[model samples]
Target: MGESAKTEETAALSVRALDDETWPAFARLVEANNGVWGGCWCVGFHVKLGKGRTAAENRAEKEQRVHEGRTHAALVFSDDECLGWCQFGSPEELPEVKSRRLYEKGLVTLPDWRITCFFTGKGLRGRGVANAALGGALAKIARLGGGTVEGYPEETDDRKVSGSFLHTGPMVAFENHGFTRTRPISPHRWVVTRTVAPA
Candidate 1:
């Protein structure tokens, strides 16, 4: 590709806050990906899953949260196509996480923001979309009065992990954005933290 064309491709990817206005695109992306992680709708972090709730119910709840302004995410887009998203919100807004048992063992305090989930569209995984999404989430958090932000990401340096298992994102992604390793919550997962200044 020519220099300008390469630049254009890079410029084409944008990050937008997930809100009512962007819900349709998010929905489309999720639906296209089989509702994401077995029809999770990315709501697994916000509430306990598998309470006999169907995927349709989960979808409704997610849509309700979006409409009520109760959910937050950074949606990555290429043109009008929603490529993926990074889910972040306050602790109360997202109470559940992987390895909670171990995470609570060292919980001295709650963070202002928690990055709980991530999803990259099929065929778009290794293209820096998740990094963009993480950057976008931090920027949005800063604008909303930033504070200590935490993430639960898996360390992938030692072994190969499927993208399907990395809902909270990879550890290097958080480290790249300046998050420090706080503690190990699971075998290959950790609790990472970063403090962002208010914009």
Candidate 2:
């Protein structure tokens, strides 16, 4: 955990878009944790669109969706090993966010992408994987044509919140990557956004 080791680890890490070819890596990271939040398969964000199914059903549907390239994510890797992941998509892909009233304020149609979820493996949790994944997701979104990207992140004070409740990440993570808070979604959560500069 020395500065130099941290630097080396950062250098060894890379981020890639989640697609059919990389689905296995993303799957492994989630599977290792028993599908994240007791077999969510990272599909809770879509429940507003009426995705009510058993964990087993959700897992199967998610896998089939990924096979069809229906998911968009940023997968962080250390050499060939997957360390973490961040999910992103057009606003249509990630809907029914928390604090709907606050989130809807000043809403517009231009922000085409939404950064919805993140997951870091057990040992990888505190090693800056989420930040890297955030950066990776933004970079990938910019590469596809920079647009307004939105996120919902918790703003924790001295009171500590468990990682289990941070799947959407924290305010600091988005801020570290240059995202600006758009509005307060809740006392602890805020809507944030960043305009990815064109590549």
Candidate 3:
């Protein structure tokens, strides 16, 4: 079977927290999808932990962040292979992210969580991988007794932005999943939220 066929066959995949044993596969996924975020390893916001660091250094820091449980980002997987990732956690837990203009909006006065980044393997883009990842994240959040989930997606008129930089995801993706635009940080970015009522 071809790659696309293999992906389709494994579409019933699930999301899980990454641990020491799974780090290598997760790192490979980020490296393979680096084209999406310029080889970010989803460290755009976590770079503050080691400012002025080289990409290699920042990557190591991010790996340490995951291993230390200082932050939490989920990995999408088919059996044991990593296919994608979603970064989410309390914004304050990510000092670099809090310093960005993207999060300056007054929306986060309280302890709101941020879903700051996403990625899928090169051949896996536009196949609803993100939606599946979001669904898995939401379920994970719910199991944690839930809290408000927020994202800052770009408001793009043209869809040609590179995937590496498109971590915010399109507005439609959030809207489709019951998230609403709380405000627009810029013409190209929006603060979207889904408040989970106390249970």
Top model by lDDT, which number? 1
lDDT per residue as tens, model 2, 1-199: 7999988878788998877777788878878888888778887776643445577877777778677776788889988788988899886767757777767775665478888888888878767788889989888888889888889888888668988778889889999899898877788887788888778
> What does candidate 3's lDDT look like per residue over 1-199, in tens digits?
7888867866767788766767898888766665334445677776553445566766787789878877676778877778887777776765455325745746447446778777788787655667777776777667667888888787667757766456767777778889988877776777788975533
lDDT of 1 by residue, 1-199 (tens): 6778866776778999999899999999888899888888999988899768778988999999999999999999998989999999999999997888899999999999999989999887656788999999999999999999999998997787998878889998999999999999988899999999999
Give the per-residue Cα lDDT of candidate 2 at 42: 83
Candidate 1: stretches off by over 4 Å: 1-8
For each candidate in turn, give its C-alpha RMSD to the true structure in angstroms: 1.6, 2.0, 3.6
Cα shift from native, residue 96, model 3 (Å): 3.2
- After the best TM-score superposition of candidate 3, give how far the Cα of residue 105 lies from its true spot, in angstroms: 4.8
Pairs in clash, predicted candidate 2: none
lDDT of 1 at 22: 95
User: By TM-score, who's the top model here?
Assistant: 1
Pick by TM-score: 1 or 3, better one: 1
TM-scores of all models? 0.95, 0.91, 0.82
In angstroms, how far off is 147's CA in candidate 1? Answer: 0.2
In candidate 3 the C-alpha lDDT for residue 30 amounts to 66
Residue 140 CA error for candidate 3 (Å)?
A: 1.4
